[model samples]
Target: MRGGNQMSQLMKQAQKMQEDLAAAQEEVALMKAEATAGGGMVRLVMGAGHQVETLEINPDVVDPQDLEMLQDLLTAAFNDAASQLDQMTQERMAEVAGGGLGLPGF
Candidate 1:
């Protein structure tokens, strides 16, 4: 009877943890991370779900003669935003899971 009660309690705790994780994931999906490059001439906003929410380019950075430079700046801004979003999601998940998920190979 004691062992059964302990197992039941553990199952309940696991279910609660799973619920918390799902809620945290939903919150993170709605969060946004922003990054800029070329002195803020290019900006990108990314969601935790790895989706680009918005992108802005300053008129001053648009040069028909140097499209390559503009492309490079855009790439840099996108990479920065994606990286930020990844870190934010990971940190949030860790917090939700109480430090770590404890899964093998993470």
Candidate 2:
């Protein structure tokens, strides 16, 4: 009987943890991160789901003769935005997991 009680308590704790994780994920989904490159010539905003939410390019940087440079700046901005979003998601998940919950990829 005591073992059964312990098992029930453990199950309750697990359910609560699951709920917390879901809440954290929902919060993260509403978060956003932004990054820039080429001294702000190119900018990117990323959603928590790693989706590009917005992109801005300075008109002064648009050069018909130097398209490759503009491409490089855009790529760098995108990379930075993606990295920031990834870090933010990881941090939020870690917090939800209480630093480490034996959960895979947490």
Candidate 3:
């Protein structure tokens, strides 16, 4: 029953891969990425799971009359940080998903 044995081995491999993927996801969630906007006036850090860890704004960019401008900078900074988080997650997951599985674009 060589074929049966091979199937069992394959099942084991798949189970191991699933475990690895779960671990990788947890790692990625803890990973952080950062971004800045408005010439570094707005900065933010985001986790790979899309949670904002921190945000900082330079006082010089905070105009009392320019609420819209301040809002725009904040939005841009958050979006950039989120994009970075996405990239970080993809790269980290790929390390686990591409472990000799011959999977396409893991």
Candidate 4:
């Protein structure tokens, strides 16, 4: 009977862990990270899921003759934003996982 009780307690612990992880994921899903490039010519905001939420390009940097420059700045900005988003998401998820799911067996 003692062994059966332990198993039951373990099952309950696992269920609680699952619930916490789900909640953490939800919070992470709504998180965002931001970055700038080309001396602030481009500003980008990226979601935790790697989605581009907002991208703002300074009008002065938009040159029709030198479109390549604009493209470069955009690329830099997006990569920076993506990197920030990745770091933020990883940190958030780590917070939930680092507790070892609060399970004694783990």
Candidate 2 at residue 34, lDDT? Answer: 93
Q: In each prediction, how many residue pairs overlap at the backbone (N, C-alpha, C within less than 3 A)?
A: 0, 0, 0, 0
lDDT of 1: 0.85
> 19 in model 2: Cα distance from truth in Å?
0.4
Every candidate's CA RMSD: 2.9, 3.1, 2.6, 2.2
Residue 64 in model 3: lDDT = 89
Candidate 2: deviation at residue 51, Å? Answer: 2.2
Using lDDT as the yardstick, the better of models 2 and 3 is 2
TM-score of each: 0.85, 0.84, 0.83, 0.83
lDDT to native, each model: 0.85, 0.86, 0.85, 0.84
**Model 3 C-alpha lDDT per residue in residues 54-95, reported as the tens digit of each score:** 899999998989999999999999988888888888888878
lDDT per residue for candidate 1 within 45-72, as digits (tens), equals 8886678888999999999999999999
Best by TM-score: 1
Per-residue CA lDDT of model 2 for 22-69, tens digit only, reads 998898889888999999999899886678889999999999999999
What's the distance in Å from true for residue 8, model 2? 2.4
Q: Candidate 2: misplaced stretches above 4 Å? A: 99-106
- Worst 10-residue lDDT window for candidate 1 reads 97-106
